[model samples]
Target: MTANATLSPADAVQGQLEAYNAQDLDAFCAFYADDAELGAYGGETHTRGLAAIRERHAKLFADFPQNHARLLHRAVVGAHVVDHEHVTRAPGGEVFEVCAIYSFAGGKIARVDFVK
Candidate 1:
C-alpha cells in the first residue's frame, strides 16, 4: 500500500483521503479491498468490484484533471467511518459538498456509500 500508514480502517480511510487529495491513484486504491463496492447514497449507480472501481476512478481522475476532496469533518463508529468533504472539480468546475460512508473488511475498504 502506498500509504505506509496504519492498518486500522480509520487510519486507512484517513490515508485514503490523503491519497485522494493528492491524486495518487495507486495509493488511493491500496486502501481498498479487491472486492470493494462503490455506490451512491440513493443507489442510482454502483461499481461492483475492484477492477470496476479502478476503471471508474481512472476515468474520473483523467476527466477532472484537477479534482480533489478536502475533508471537512470525520466521524467513526465501529467499522464504519464517515467523512464530510468539499470536492473541487477540474477545468474550472464548481465545488460541492458530499458525505462518504465507508465500510471496512479484512483491513481494507469493502464498500463506500457517497451521499451527495
Candidate 2:
C-alpha cells in the first residue's frame, strides 16, 4: 500500500484523487479491493476484478490525463461508506457529480457502486 498523510477512508480516497490528478494510475488503483468491481454510471459497462478495473482506468487515465475527484459529502454507517463527489476534467474544465457507495473489508474497498 502507498503511505500518505490520510487517516480516514475519506482521507484515503482524497489521496487517491490526488494521485489521479497527478496521472499516477498505480497509486490510484491501489486504493481498491483485489476483486473490486467498478460499475459505470448510466452505462452498461462494469469492470470486475483488479485486472479489469486496471484496464478500465487505463483508458480513463489516457482520455482524461488531468482528472481530479473531490468528495463533497459523506455518510458512514459502520463499514459502509457513501460519498457524494464532484470529479473535474481539468482539460475541459467540466465537473460531474456522482454518488458512490463502497463496502470496505480489512481496510480495503471490496465493492463500489456508482449512482447518478
Candidate 3:
C-alpha cells in the first residue's frame, strides 16, 4: 500500500496545514494526490495538479514569508474535512478568514475548495 493509503483524511489535512505554516513545500504537497484540484468554493479552478499546487504555493510562501494560518474550527465527515481558519500574511499585515473543504480519496487529499 502507498503511504497515503494509510493516512487518514484528518491527518492529511492537518499535516498540510502544519507544513504550510512551516513553509515546507515538499511536505505540504505530500498530503495531496498527484491530480488533486484546488479552486474557489463555487467559482473558477485555481490549481489542477500537485505540480501546479506546488508552483502556486511556492510563490505565496516567497511573497509572504511570515504568513501563518490559525485553525478556528475543523470537522470531519466521511472522506471530507472542513476547516475554518484565520490567516495573516505577515505580522500586522493582511488578515482574512477562510473556510476550506478538503476532499479525500485513497487517503490523500483529492481536492480543496476555498471560501474566502
Candidate 4:
C-alpha cells in the first residue's frame, strides 16, 4: 500500500460516476486540483487547468453522445483512490476498461493518471 492507505478518504467515486453519467464536464473535472494532470486512453499527458478538461469532455460527448462510465472497482488508501472503470458507448456497445489513480492534496485531486 502507498502512503494514503491509512487516511481512507471519502468515497468520491460515486460523484465521479454521477458527473460523467450526467455529462457535467465541469462537475466531473471538479474532482481535480487546480493544476491537475490527466493522461486518458494512454495518450499524451495533459497538464492543464479545469477548463481544458471541461472542453475535452465536451468534445468527447459531442462525438459519442451515448457514452457512459461505470465504476467497477475502487480502493481507498488515505487521500488516494484507485478507481477501475468500464466505459460503454451507447446503451450496450463496446466496453473499454481503465484504471485511474487519484492522489489528493487537501481535498482536491493533485494528480490523475490512468491507462487501459
Candidate 5:
C-alpha cells in the first residue's frame, strides 16, 4: 500500500484504458503505481516498475500508431477489475480479443495479468 491515493482503483484503471485508446503513453502510464507489474499473456512478467512499463508501452505506441483497444466489457470486484477487450493493430496486423485482469493498490494499478 502507498500514500496520497486519490483515485479509486477502478477509476485509475479506467483512466489508463482511456489513455491507452488515445495512444497517449504519458497519460496511460500515469495511472500505474511506481512499482507496478505487468504479466503478459502466456508469458512471464514482461515489465516491472513504472519506468519500464512506460518504455514498453511507448515502444508499442510508436511502433503501431494504429493500435487500439476496445473495451467490450468490465467487471469490478473489490480492488480488482477484469476487462474484456478487442485489440487491433493496423488493418493487416493481428486482431484479437483479450481479457486483462487488473489489481489495484493505493488507488493505482499495482499489477496486470493479460489473458489472450
Candidate 6:
C-alpha cells in the first residue's frame, strides 16, 4: 500500500486545508488525485485536473499573500468530508464563509464542491 492509502478521508482533507492556509501549492495539491475536479456546489466545474487546480490556487495565493481559512466545523461521511470554513483574504480584509464538500477515492481527494 502507498503512503496515501493510509490516510483517512478526514485526515486528507485537513492536510490540504493546512497546506492551503500556508499557501504551499505543491503540498496543497498533494492531497488531490491526478484527475481531481473542483467546482461549485451544484454549478459548473471551475477546475479540472491537478495542474489546473494548482494554477488557479497559485494566482489566489499570489493575489492574497496572507490568505487563510479557519475551520469552523467538519463532518466525515464515508468517502466524503464536508468542511465549514471562514476565509480571509488578508488581515482585516475580505472575509467569507464557505462550505466545501470533498470526495475521496483511493485515499486521495477526487473532487471538491464549494458552497458560498
TM-score to true structure, per model = 0.89, 0.77, 0.95, 0.78, 0.89, 0.95
Q: Which pairs clash (backbone N, Cα, C closer than 3 Å) in model 4? A: 4-77, 4-78, 8-78
lDDT of 1 by residue, 1-116 (tens): 35433477778898888887777888888888889999898685478888898888888888887898888999999999999999999656888999999998887899999998
CA lDDT, candidate 3, residue 103:
96
What's the lDDT for candidate 6?
0.91
Q: 63, model 1: CA deviation in Å?
A: 0.8
Q: After superposition, how far is residue 15 of candidate 4 from its true place, in Å?
A: 0.9
| Residues 28-90, model 3: lDDT tens digits | 988889999999999898899999999999999999999999999999998999999999999
What root-mean-square deviation over C-alphas does model 4 reach?
5.4
Candidate 2 lDDT tens digits, 1-116:
36243446665666566676677878877877788777755555487887887787889889887777787898888777788988987756888998988776656666778987
Question: What's the candidate order when arranged by decreasing lDDT?
Answer: 3, 6, 5, 1, 2, 4
Two-way lDDT contest, 1 vs 2, winner:
1
RMSD of each: 2.1, 3.4, 2.2, 5.4, 3.3, 2.2
Model 5: per-residue lDDT, tens digit, 7-39? Answer: 766677778888888888878887888999999
lDDT of 5 at 4: 30
TM-score of 5: 0.89
Report, for all candidates in order, the number of backbone clashes: 0, 0, 0, 3, 0, 0
Poorest lDDT segment (10 consecutive residues) of candidate 3: 1-10
Scored by CA lDDT, what does every candidate get?
0.85, 0.74, 0.91, 0.71, 0.86, 0.91
Q: Candidate 6 lDDT, tens digit per residue, 1-116?
A: 12266799988888898899888888898998999999999899989999999999999999999999999999999999999999999988999999999998888899999999
lDDT of 4 by residue, 1-116 (tens): 11222233444556656777888777777665577667764577775766677777888888778898888888888777888988997876777998988777756666778888
When summed lDDT is taken over every stretch of 10 residues in candidate 6, the lowest stretch is 1-10
Which pairs of residues collide in model 5?
none
Q: In model 6, how large is the Cα lDDT of residue 81? A: 97
